[model samples]
Each structure stands twice: as C-alpha cells, then as structure tokens.
Target: MEVAELKAIIEGLLFASGDEGITVKQLQKVLGISKETVDHLLEELKYEYERRDRGIMIMSSNEVLHLTTKPEHSDYYKKLLEVPQSSRMSQAALETLAIIAYRQPITKTEIEDIRGVKSDRPIQTLVTRSLIEEVGRKESVGKPILFGTSKEFLTYFGLTSLDELPPLPDTDEPEDINQEADLFFERFNDELE
Candidate 1:
C-alpha cells in the first residue's frame, strides 16, 4: 500500500479506538507492518493534523495512540458539558437506571439478568448521563465492574440519599417483578416531570 493509504488506515484505527487508544503492538500486527513503519506513519499523521489546524488531533501516551480534540478547543468542549439536560430518558435507560438504583453495587451480568436482555447500551447511557458509575469490581472471577448510583442520581431524583427511595412492595411472582420495575420507573418519571 502507498504511504498515504497507510497513514489513513492508522488514523481510522486511532479514531475507532476511542479513549482506550490503540497500542503500538496492536497497530503493527493489524497493518502487518514493522514497528518503525507504524511509528513513522503516526508521526506524519500527527504533523499533518497540526499543520492543517484540525479540530481533532492524534495523541500518544505510553505507546498508545488515540484521537482527541485539540487543546485549543477546550472552551467548546466545556460548553457542551454545561448544556442542560433537555431530553427525556428512553425506556431502556429508565429500566437500567431502575435496576441500578435499587440494586446497589451490581454487575452488568446481574443487571442483564434482571432486564432479560443485553444492557450494554442502556448502561452506557446511564454512565453518560452521570446517573451511574463504576463503584468497584466484584470479587468473583474476572472481577467484573460493579455499578452504583452517583451523587448526580440523587440530585436528579430530588433525593438527599438512597435511603429516600420509596420502599418496594413485596411480591413472589416472576411477572410481578417486571411490573414492579415499571411501576418504579413510572413513579420516578412522574416526579421528574
């Protein structure tokens, strides 16, 4: 492949990697190129971004490369972070929030079990909304991340503490469990509105 095509591929890989960033070894293996070639391409891409005055730029740390907004654009990013929450939560996000709120320090697997579906998107939404966070890791194998409500959750719900949450009614039936969750979501949404 041409040098230009190699640089483009490296740029795409960096962008797609997001915050985790792509390691030098990973890039070399994927492109089937030598480490020196990957390093040279990355430096060229970095210089091009700087020379062109692009809004986004390539960043490297500890042999990992990722794309990030230029430092000069910090003001714009701050404005975005300060934007008010004008949108309502989706049903899946509401359900995921309900599960996390009630079951403190729960793992994704436990949340999925309760919701009866993959909860990755909903969990990500909750984290983005600042309603939930990774409190710690479970002690079992793999030590999966344990999520719990953030202080933002209390502020959003107008509760001073988790203890202020309404008591759940007792029910033994499997169907009642889902109904109870829906009820909690409805009540929470009603209060917010």
Candidate 2:
C-alpha cells in the first residue's frame, strides 16, 4: 500500500524472476498498480541501490527488469568463479552442459524440455563460468539465444576437440529420464577423473 512496501515487493519480484526478468507490464499487473507507479518505484529502487552502495543494481533489458550485479564488480565475480571449489558443477549444470555440448547451438527451452525442469540457473552458471556461451539466435519466434559449448569447455574437460566426446548409448529402448541423466553423468565423470 505504501511506497516503501511497494518498492520492497518489486525488489522481491525482480529477484524471484531470475535471469528471465520481469516486465513492467507484469509488475503492474502483479501489484495492481499503474505503469507510472511501477516506473517510479523502479527508478527509486535503482537510485536507492546506487546511493546505498549495494552490490546489486536493477538493470533493464528488452523491457525486462532484473536484479544484477554491478558491472564494476566484475573482477571479483570472475575471481569467485575461478575458485577451485566453484569449478565443480551441480548435476543440473552437468546435465545442461551435456545437452549443449552434444546438441550445439540449442535454446534454453529445448534444454528444459529435455531435462523436464527449468534450466535457467544452470545455463546462467555455465555462462558465468565461461563453459557455455551464446553462439547465436534461433530463427524462430523471439529469436531466443542458442547456447553452445565454449572453447573453455574443451580446455576444462581436457579435450582438444568435441570429437573427443564419447558416443551416446542407443535410445531405441525407451528409458527413464533419470537413466538418461545417469548415463550422461557417468560418462562425463569418467572423463573428468
């Protein structure tokens, strides 16, 4: 109801939106507020973050708003990513990476469809770690970004080329999704060790 409460709610919405981000229209609808109020709240929030010297700031891209780390802090972020402990990938990240490594230039939606779960965080982690990158945009609706393995991927996996990847097992037999994921994990883990 109050301006402060409105701003706080908007902040939470932005955070929960993750990499996909929230649009002004969506925010307005969610909060039952007008576009002008949403815009004012966003600008005020941005100014407060800047004035408060916060690590994250509000960013707008293609009409979507997200809470993103300040670009000036990129050096620290890069170092954080380089830490040995951070090198270990989660099962989801490994699954997403395997799909991208094999498929090459695949969309996030496609990856999610295969994994049967949202791949945003895994994709973000892979991109931040430089193991995957935006190879190009698909020609379909929205021209969604197509992700592919980066050169760093090969280096990290100790491979000179993608040709070094092991062949996939035959899919002629209908298998459970978990079985497929385990197969991928086992193959990659063997390669890693």
What tens digits encode model 2's per-residue C-alpha lDDT throughout 1-193? 9999999999999998898899999999999999999999999999988954689999989988989999888999999867776345787888888888877889999988888778889998899889999999999999999999999988887789999876766665323444564575557666665
- lDDT for each candidate structure: 0.84, 0.85
Model 1 off-target regions past 4 Å? 85-125, 148-193
In candidate 2, list every pair of residues with a backbone clash. Answer: none
lDDT of 1 by residue, 1-193 (tens): 9999998898888876766789989999999999999889988888888965588888779878779888888999999989887547878888888888888889999988888877877888899989999999999999999999999999887889999877766976645665676677777777666
Residue 126 CA error for candidate 1 (Å)? 1.9
Q: Which ten residues in a row have the lowest lDDT in candidate 2?
A: 172-181
Q: So what's the TM-score on candidate 2? A: 0.57
In model 1, what lDDT does residue 17 have? 74
